[model samples]
Target: MLDTEAFRDRMATLPHDLSEYARVQTGPASWSAHPHAEELSAWALEDHVDPALVRTTALLVDISPTDVPHVAVPHADVAQLVSHREAFVVASINGEATLETMLDIVGLPSGELLAIICSLCARGIVALDRSHRLVTR
Candidate 1:
């Protein structure tokens, strides 16, 4: 028993541009410095649409859970994009480690970690290799 009219009204009330609502006030300088700021902001928006799932599917379409997650970018470059727990996940990767291993090491909820990974991937800061392993672009 759903109220179709009410649902339509509620949906109409939502912002036409969710990204406008999601935009962070990083100031003018940050926006200019970071070429991917808008993309990141779009990724940060957590509506019913899952950006992580979309990005993961598009980029690693053939990847499996067993695929090893590796950090190919230099630590200094990674510092610019990730912080806190996300940084820990990037740092914990050494040589070869699976997604499960990263989860165990970072101890973050899967959704949160996946969001971070999606953000990095979207920024061209991380990528997947032909071997189907996560890597830095």
Candidate 2:
């Protein structure tokens, strides 16, 4: 008894790139994606992501509803995110806030939060306004 149109309408309310979030239930490993290695290495460890940059950075939606790159075959991390709704919410908030604000609002561990953002960017659902640093989800 799912209402697909209502769901699409809700998605439309978000600032995302007109893409639909896939409904899935599984561990992140099950999603089958390889969030870019370069991105992970660049931002994951020992990197406080420069307070100035984090303060100024914002995430943007890139993929369209019909073009959510991994909807048909999700990336491994997407499964992990299935339960981490806060990360998705934080991503949406990124439209106006900086990463520091995202961290303050979401309260996820920085590494985990950065990973989630990076994974989403890798997937194509989100992007840093400054660079293609993260991809999608």
Candidate 3:
């Protein structure tokens, strides 16, 4: 079941004015400076909320799912990750894959996978293309 209270609390913490953060490209298709990037990612790692729902909420809060960004690991070292699932997701990326393809390759529910991706993205470990870098997902 979805935890509405926790979800709302998380949402409340996210930045309302994303324009202030300014999308700065630290790596391939990454927006490292987004206000919600780090906070959201950290929440995903520790929060008890459903991963799939968190993924959906993340999209709604930052970018819409229809945007379907391409994702990739910017760095080679992902050994520091504590969660095996997160490490697996990082390993599964070869070059850049669509968010849909990543979901398939990682074999994790969308919520879990996306949360990991978001966390990596915040840490400059993964890059998510917000623009039309790859149209087909």
TM-score of each: 0.46, 0.33, 0.43
List the pairs of residues colliding in candidate 3.
51-111, 52-111
lDDT of 3 by residue, 14-122 (tens): 5486653555433344435576888877875786987656654564466434334433433445675436776777667665566766666667888877777677665
RMSD of 3: 18.3
RMSD of 1: 13.3
Which scores higher on TM-score, 1 or 2?
1
Q: Please state the error at residue 39 of candidate 1 in Å.
A: 22
| Ranking of all candidate structures by their TM-score, best first | 1, 3, 2
Candidate 3 or 2, higher lDDT: 3
Single out the weakest 10-residue window by summed lDDT for candidate 3: 64-73
Q: What's the CA error at residue 83 for candidate 2, in Å? A: 5.1
lDDT of each: 0.65, 0.49, 0.61
Off by over 4 Å in 3: 1-60, 63-76, 133-137
What TM-score should be assigned to candidate 3? 0.43
Name the candidate that leads on TM-score: 1
1 or 2, greater by lDDT: 1
